[model samples]
Target: MTTLPTQLQHDLQALAGEGGYRDATERDVTEMRGRYRGGSTLVLRPKTTEIAAAIVSRCAEAQLPIIPIGGATGLVAGHIASENQTGVLLSTERLVNIREINSTDRQLVAEAGVILANVQAAATAKDLLFPLSLAAEGSCTIGGNLSTNAGGVQVLRYGNTRDLVLGVEAIMPNGEILNGLSPLRKNNTGYDIKNLLIGAEGTLGLITAASLKLYPSIKDSCTALCPVASPAAALALLSQLQHELGEFISAFELISGQGLHFLREHFPQLPQAISPPPEWSVVLELGSSAENELKKLAESALTKAIQKDLILDAVISQSETQRQQIWSLREHIPLANKKVGAIVSFDISLPLSKLALFIKTAVPKVQDFDGNLRINCFGHVGDGNLHFNVFPPIDKLACNYRSQQTEIRSAVYDLVQKMGGSFSAEHGVGRDKVSELLQYGDPTKLEVMASIKKALDPNGIFNPGAVIDPRK
Candidate 1:
């Protein structure tokens, strides 16, 4: 619980001006998906890192909990605040700025509030690539990406958000600014503090800015939509294709027939590249910086795959427009499903070898709760991460099956644990999964995590109830 000092609030308002703060309504503290609800006394949108630091210092003195928010697009409910606390919703929207773009170093220094798409566009303007991408790139902020250590389409090749970040400048709970923005590729002087804050989900600190690594813009590329017999076949094709294409393989997404069905029903605008969907579909992309015979190589590799019966059918994107269109279908599935109603979304990772079995075992357990339950499994199969989503059944009686959430989650998470996988993969263990994490995570690991939390945030003033309980 937190109690705000009226004098401190007035001082902060004076420093940031009248427009910098707002009294957070009940609506402001609730999550975007409405799965998690919270309340806060005020929402502060500081325009600069100094202001943020000052706000943090004031809150620390007052012992108030500060919940940092970006675009609020996270699946883990990481941005929610508690009602008992005088929760200060610290937003970085005003801090959005592309501070510098060094073409020579192929690096961009950006404020945390900059949208992921804007950063990509900035890199593109410099003939460089910021390859971290997802459906929420337009809305999800760079800070949120760093906080979650986001993994998206290009995780197979470019790696997760943690890989792209070269340095981070964050404000620790004690109001000390940890400045580590070095664009140098090699730094072995000491411990890597940047990584600690990268996926801490605002528990350790509030990320203000980052120096991000960039890649040479891909000049040649090929995309294909293929129909496969099953997830196993898709994995096999991925392995064979990767062995042949090597580093050229950028994105390989596996989509189930039911996932495709949702896209077709909700998003009629997207073109279906393959007819009469097989049990599974794959959207694969290959890219290269220097111009090469990419199309020929892709076609030949795909031809070999088809001949081997690894792929049932395939459609290659002839042009850039076609590639984007194919990607739209893959990206729009989540948004399309949201229009209908709520969903229990799981972002889990299993070993590539065990993905097929994990999906097979989990689907039946979910269906046993409601036979007509809509299970849409799709994600970066190359990275062994899948977005396993369960939508409510069409039948009203069937839709009222909330009681099965625990059983279904346990079944899926248990399989993930058995396979040496993470129940919370790309998504951090926010309040929503704290209990599950306590149950599944190693006790020793949790102890170390708690020790670190105590070391950095002794007062527990930063994003309470996130990642781990400070009170514990």
Candidate 2:
């Protein structure tokens, strides 16, 4: 729908209530990383599932594309509306409610618009843990998190957004409601529709609410910043720590010296934990119910690792404030990357054994494309996901290198494919990576995905150009 009828907004307002319809904010059009922006403006916020269904029904009749937006913290261009104006931008913001928290069930039912931090706070109130933590958790909504199947620091211990969700309540493309919000461990009733919508990036449907799994609140924990010699050394240290700490090992993050330099350059206010950060480092965290025992174990293990020369220095947190500071160092690297402006960033994953090798090989390959490019490689090493980003030299801006961006991206992605890794890991194949998915995706898999998209959203009105492009 190139130009929707102006009456459509009033029709949606009447359906979802006056407060639900409004012009889109700038944030609504731009993705989190500021890499991509859209031009649509019609925004709709429905309060309830019934109201959401009604809005979809009206759009379906009018054949208007409906872009479902959440907290708009997505790195991919998933939430941005189409290039053409007049598509209805449906937001789940008004669906902010925690309908249930059952300790016995070990689950919490949350509306799609509930801020992830709010859900964590609610679980904390119940003396339980939500286990999903992200830099954008304070603003990213549950809907977007689930939509992207987001991965964060705790994915090593728990899992991705799909792993945390038990069920979801969504509106299908034909304006029908999919009420699959059942908090069950084993419900072999049919196809796992809940998991289907969890990572579909809203191309499949507009998720309204979800039933999420919760865990026991961590009783005791330890956070450490261990500086290693190289990515290979960091991988070796991770193997040792996992053997020693086992499931208690909650997060194992790999950081590059380049990332630290970026941090110091951009965010000088953030306290540097280690002196002259090593060539590589890792922020290792352990969480468990046993008090004091985990820290003793960690301290002992770190001593052994030092003796083995696996780590050069260690900055273990002794207090909550200090732990947050250490984590702040890890979390702020991406912000620094954005400030420096990456020419191209890759969110790719490989087998645990292939990680160090891929990093080593991909670096020189990207540098070969242009020797002036500097790379920042880091992320959740425990889970094999790496946010490998390429940027310009310290004195240069990314815009100056824009002409070479496409070739550099292709070189990196081809290597990622040849090394038996994924081009898109935790970040879903939003509009940004849609073509990459098509280029590297398995033919059979793409065919099946197209089939599913056709079955669920035949009209192509549901996020038409996102995961799969609409028919010409």
lDDT of each: 0.86, 0.89
User: What TM-score would every model get versus the actual structure?
Assistant: 0.96, 0.98
For candidate 1, give the lDDT of residue 267. 81
In model 1, pairs of residues that clash are: none
Q: Point to the candidate with the largest lDDT.
A: 2
Tens digits of per-residue lDDT, candidate 2, 1-472, equal: 2656668766877898868878778889888888777877777888899999998988888887888899998887998875665587889989999999999999999999999999999999999999999888889999999999999999998989888988899999999999888878889887998887888999988999999999999999999999898888888998998888889999999999999999989999999998686778999999986575777899999999999999987888999999999999998998998898899999999998899899889899999977878999999988999999999987888899899999988998998898899999898888888889889999889899999988988888888788885552
Looking at model 2, the pairs that clash are none
Tens digit per residue, CA lDDT, model 1, 1-472: 3656778778777756657887776546677666777776677898889888988888888787889999888877788876675767888888899999998888899999999999999999999999999999999999999999999899999999999999999999998898988788889989899999999999998999999999999999999999988899999999999899999999999888877777777887778777665569899999999997889998999999999999987889999899998898889877866765544778899989899998888898888877888888988888999889888876553247678777788888887898899888788888889988888989999899999998998888888888896557
Q: Write down the lDDT that model 1 would get.
A: 0.86
Off by over 4 Å in 2: none
RMSD of 1: 1.7
